[model samples]
Target chain A: MKQRFLKAAAIILWLLIWQILAMIINKELLLPSPYITIKTLISKMSESSFYIALLYSLFRIIIGFLIAVVFAFILGVISGLSKNAEILLSPLITVIRSTPVMSFIILAIIWFSYNLAPLAVNIIMCFPPIYDNVVKGITNTDRKLLDMAKVYDIRPLKIFKGIYLGSVKPFLAAGMNTALGLAFRVAVAAEVLANPKYGIGTKLLQAKYNLETAEVFAWTFMILLLSYLFEYIFKIIIESRRYNAQTRKSDKVI
Target chain B: MLRLENLTKSYNDNYIFKDFSMVIEKNRITCLLGKSGSGKTTLLNVLSSITDEFKVKYSDFEKLRYSYIFQEPRLLEWYTVYKNLQFVLDNTHMSKQAIHEKIMDSLKMVEMEKYADYYPYQLSGGMAQRVSIARAFVKDFDVLLMDEPFKGLDPTQKEDITDRFLKMWRENRKTVIYVTHDLDEALYMAYDIHVLGEHPTKILYTSRNAYKMNDTERENERDKIWQILRSQI
Candidate 1:
C-alpha cells in the first residue's frame, strides 16, 4: 500500500511539473497541459473509431507476437539440439539483433501491404530475445537430472515434456515479457510509418498533422497503458502457472 | 552371477579402469568401499551403462533393467515427488492406477508419503534423498546401483534411511551394487565388501561379511577394511 501511494505521488508530481510548464508556455499547440490531455483521452475513449483503431493495432501486434514465439521456439530447439544448426543460424540471428527496428519497418513497407507492415515489423523485432533466451534455457538444463532421465530409460517424449519443457518455461516467460513490450512499441511505430488504414498510430499521425498536441499526448498515453496492461497480464499468467504447480494437491492414498 | 569382464575406461588418456573385472552375485548387496578417487562411481556408471565410452563385456546381464541413486538426491526440481516417480514408471506398461499405487507404496516405505505433493525444493536434503530412493524403488529394475546415496546425511538420518532402504531391499532382494567411502556404511549394509584402490582402479581386498556376525567381529572387519583404504591414501 505504501509503495503504491508513493508511486502515485511520483506520477502526480511529474504531471504537476508538466501542467506548470504548459501554463507558462501559454500555447496549446506548443504544450498541452495534463488536464487537456486527459480530457482529450476521455473524449477519444467515447468515440467508436478510437476503439476500432485500438483493436486494430492490438490484434495485429498480438498475432505477430504469437507467430514470433512459435518460430523462435522451433528455431531455438533446433539450435539447442545441433551445433551445426546453431552455427548456420548464428549470423542471421546476429544481423536481426543488430539491425534497427526502423530498417525492418521500411523494408516491410516496401514488401508487404501497409496493413501487414506493422505485423511483419512486430515479428522481426520480437524474435531475437525470445530465441536467445530459449536456447540458453535448453543448453543450461541440469546435466544431473538429464543423466537420471537417461538411466531410467525414460521415453524421449517424456524427457522432452518433463525435463526440457520445464527448463524452457521460465526462459520463455522472461523472453515473452520483453518481447511483448517491444512488440507494442515497434508495431505502433510501424503503423505510423506504414499509415495503416485503422490503428492508433494512424490516429496519432493524423493528430500530429492537425497540430492536435493534446490528442497526440492522449494516444501516446494509451499506448503506454496498453503495453503495461499486456505485460502485467502475461506476468500474472506465468506466475499463476507456477503457483498452481507448486500448490497442486496429490491424491491421498488409502 | 553378473560379470563385467575386461573393462577399460579412459578420460583424456588417463585410465580409470583397465582390464578390470568384477563378479556381482545377483540379488545380493555388494559394497565397493574406496577412497575419493578410486573409481567406485565410474564402475557403477559402467555397470548401469550410463557411460558408453568404456570397452566392457557383460556376462549373464542381458535383459537387466538398472536404477541409479546418485550421491546427490538429483530429484527433478520442477516436479513433485509423485511426478518424479511417475516420470520413470509411466512407460512400464503399468496402468495409471498401478503406477500410483507403486509410487505411494515406495514413498510410504521411505516415510515420505505425506510429501508426495511437495516439490524437491520444499523438502529437506534428507527428505529429498529419501524421495530419490523412493523414485528408484518405484521403477521396475533388476539391479540398483547406489553411488553413496547416504553420504551427506546426519548420522541419525543416514541410519534411519539406511534401515528403510534395507527393509525395502529385504522385500524385493534386487541385485544391488552399493558404492561408498564410509567403512561403517559398508559394514552395516553389505553382504560382501570390496576395498578398491586408485590409478587404473583395482580391488585391494574383498571380505565376505556373514550377516550373522556379532558386533566385535563386525568391528574387526571394519578395522581391516579401514587398513586397506588407508594403505591406498
Candidate 2:
C-alpha cells in the first residue's frame, strides 16, 4: 500500500508538471492541459470505434504472446534435453535475438495485414528471451537431482512435473514477465508503423499530427494500464505454484 | 547373490582397482575399509551403478535395484526432510499408507522425527546426512550402499547413526555395504571388512568377525586398521 501511494504521488507530480508547462505554452492546439486530456479520453471511451480497436489490438497482441510462450517452452525443452537439438536450433535463436523488431514489423507488413504486422513483431519479440532462459534453467539443473530421479526410474509424467518443472519454474516465470513487457511495447510500436485502423496506435499517430500532447499522454497512460493489468494477472497465476506445491494434512492437494 | 567378479575400474588410465573381486553374502553387512585414495568410494559407486565406467565379468544380473547414501547428504534443498521421504515414496509400488508408515519408522530410527517438517537447507551438515540415511532406509531397496556416510560427524552422532543404520539393516535385511576411512566404523558395523591398498588398488587384508560390540577397548583394532590405511596412503 505504501508503494502504491508513492507511485500515485509520482504520477501526480508528473501530471502537474505537464499541466503547468501547457499553461506556459498557452496554446490548446500545441498542448491540452490534464483536464482536457481526461475529457478527451472519457469522450473517446464512449465511442464504439474505440472499444472495437481495443478488442482487435488486444486479441492480436495477446494471441501472439501466448503462441510465443508455447513455442519457446517446447523448443526450450527439446534443446535442454538433447545436445544435437541445441546445436541445430541455437543459430536460429541467435538470429531472432539479434534482429530488430522494426525490421520484422516492416517485413511482416509486406507479407501480412496491419493486424498481423504487429502480431508477428510481438511473436518475434517474446520468443528469444523466453527460450534462452528456460533452456539454460533446465540444462543447469543439479546433476545429483537428475541421478536421484533416474535411480527411482520414475514415470515420465512424474519426471516432468516433479523434476523438470520444479527446476525451471523461476526461469520460465521470469522470462514470461520480461517478455510480457517487451511484447506490449513492440506490439504498439509495430501498430504505429503499420497504421492499424481504430487501434491506440492510430489515435497516437493522429495526436502527433494534430499536436495534441495531452491526448497522446492519455493514450500512453491507457497502454501502460493495460500492459500492467496483463502482467499483474500473469504474475498471480505463476506465483500460485508455490501454493500448489503445498499439500494439506487432510490429504487435499493445494 | 551380490558379486563383483574381476571388476576393472579406472580414471584417465589410472586404475582405481584392477581384477578386484568381492562377494557380499545376502542379508549381512559388508564393510569396505580403506584410506581416502584406496578406491573405497569408487568400488561402492561401481556396485551401485553410479559409476558406469567400470567393467565387471560374470555378474550378468546387473538389474538389481539399489539405494545409495553418498558422502554428501545430497538431499533436495527445496523440500522439508519429511517431504523428501514422502516424495521418493510417491511413485513406489507401495501404498500411500505403507509409505507414511515407512517415513514414520525411518524418522524414529535417526531420532529425527521432530525435524520431519524442516527443509534440508535448514539442517546442519550432520542432520542433513542423517536425513539422507533415513531416505535410504525407507526406500525398500534390495541393497543399501553408504559411502563415508558419517563424514563430518562427531563421535556421538556417528554412534547414533551407526546404531540406527544397523537397526534398519536388521529390520529390512537388505544387503548393506558401507564404505568409510574411519577404522572403527568398519570394526563397529561389519560382519566382514575388505581392506584395500594403493596404486592399482587391491585387497591388502580381510578380517571376518573383526570386532565385537560392548568391547569398548577399541584402541588395538583401530590402530591395526589405521596402520593398513596409512601404509596405502
Candidate 3:
C-alpha cells in the first residue's frame, strides 16, 4: 500500500514537470498547462453540447467495438477450425492490420455516412488484433485434453464449455483490452475528418479553427479521461469474468 | 477386444516397433515390461488408435472407446478438479445423484475427494497423477490405458493406489493395458505380461503370470520380478 503512494507521487511529479514546461512556453496554442486544461473542462461541464458530443461519440465507438468483437470472434473461429480458411483469410487480415489508420478514416469518410464513418474506421482498426489473439488462443489449447474429449465422445457443447471457452478467454480479454484503445483513437479521428456535428471530434475541430487552444487541450484530456473511464469499468467486468473463466462444468448431452 | 497385429512405428529412420503384436485380453490387466525407448508408449498409442507416427492395423475391434492416463497428469491448467472429471464422462444417463456418487467414489479411490474443487495448479505432482487416474477411470471406457501412472509415487502411495485400483477393477471390470518399466509392478498387477525389447521393437518375452498368492507373498514375488528386471533392463 505504501508502494502505491510512491507510484502516485511519481505521477504527480511528472505532471508537475509538464505544467512547468507549459508555463515557460507561455503559448496556449502550443501547449496549455494542466490548470488551464482543467478549468476549461470544468466550465464545459455546464454545457449540454459537451454531454451530447461526448455521449454521441461514446455510443458510436462502443457499437463499433462490439461489432469488431463479434466479427473477429467469428472469423477467428472459422480460421482456427480450418487451416484452409486461415490461408484464405490471412491476406485480408494482413491488409487491414498493415493499412494506415488515417488512410482508412479518409476512405471511410467518402464511403460511408458521416455518422457511420467512425464506426467503419473503428471496426477496421479493431478486428485484426482481436482476431489474431483469438486465433492464437485456439491454436494453443491443449492437444492432449482435446484427445481425451474426442475419445470419450464428449458432446460438442460440452467440449466447448469445458475446453474451448476456457482456453480462449485470456486471448479474448487481451484482444478486447487492445481493441478498446484502438477503437476510441480511430473513432475520434474519423469523427474529426468526417465532421460529425455532435461528436467530440467535431468540437475538437471547432476549437482548432477558433484558436481556443485551452478548449482543445480540455477536449483532448476529456477523451483521455473518457477512454480511461470506460476501460476501468470494463476492466472490472472483464477481470470478474476472468476470475470465474476456469470454473468449467460440462454440459450433459448424449 | 483390442488387437494389434504387425503394427510398426518409425520416426525418421528410427524404428520403435517392427511387427510387434499383442492381443490385449478383455477385462484383464496387461503390463508391458521394458527399458526406455522400448516402444512401450508407442505400442500403447497404437493400441489406442491415436498413434501419430505408427502404421497400425487392428483386426477384431470396431469403434472401441479408449481413455488414457498419460505419464503426466495432463490436466488442463485452467480448470477445476470436478470439471476435469466431467470433461471425459461418456455416459450422460447417470443421474445427478449417481454422478455425484461416482465422482465421490473415483476421487475417493485416489484419495483426491477433498481436492475436488481445487485447480490443477494447486495440486502436488502425486495429487495431480491421482486426479488423472480418477479422470481416466471416471470415463467408462472399454479400455483404460495408463502410461507409467505410478512413475513419481512414493512406495506407500504407489502400493495404496495399486490396491485401491485392483479393488475398483474387480468391481468395474475394464480391459486395462498398463505400461510400466518396473517388473515388480507387472508381477503384482498383470495377469499377462509382454516385454517390449530393443529398437525395431519385437516381443522380447511374453508370459501368463497367474495371481494365486496371499498379499505378502504377492509383494515378495514383486521383489523377485524387480531383481530379475534390474539386471535385464
lDDT digits (tens) for residues A39-118 of candidate 1? 99999999999999999999988999999999999999889878899999999999999998889999999999999999
TM-score of each: 0.96, 0.86, 0.90
lDDT of 1 by residue, B1-233 (tens): 88878889999899999988888888899999898989998887777667778887654554578899999998877788889889888556778788789889999999999988877877788999999999999888999999999888999999899999999999989999999988887888999888889689987888885465898898887788777777886
**Model 3 regions lying over 4 Å from their true place:** A244-254, B12-14, B52-58, B213-233
The residue-by-residue lDDT of candidate 3 on B1-233, one tens digit each, is 56777777788887777676777789889888888877788776666666566666654434678878888888877677887887777456878888877788889888889888778877777788889888888866788888998888899878987887788789888888889988778887898878776568776666565466668867766665555456555
* Poorest 10 consecutive residues by lDDT, candidate 3 chain B: B53-62
Question: In terms of TM-score, which candidate is strongest?
Answer: 1
Fnat, model 1, is: 0.59
lDDT of 2 by residue, B138-229 (tens): 77677778888788888898887778778767776878788887776788788778888877888888776664534644665667777877
- Could you give me the TM-score of model 1 versus the true structure? 0.96
Tens-digit lDDT track for model 3 on A31-148?
A: 9999999999999999999999999899888999999999999889778778899999999998998888888988898898888888888987989889998898888888877876
The per-model lDDT (C-alpha) reads 0.88, 0.79, 0.81
lDDT of 2 by residue, A1-254 (tens): 99999999999999999899999999887778888888888987998977887887787678989999999999999899888999999899888888877788899999999867888888988999899888987898878777776665556777676678777878899898999998878888888899887677777888889887877877877789899999999988876654334432223211
Name the DockQ score for candidate 3: 0.36
Query: Considering only N, C-alpha and C atoms within 3 Å, which residue pairs clash in candidate 1?
Result: none
Question: TM-score (0 to 1) of chain B, per candidate?
Answer: 0.95, 0.88, 0.85
Residue B129's lDDT within candidate 3 is: 83
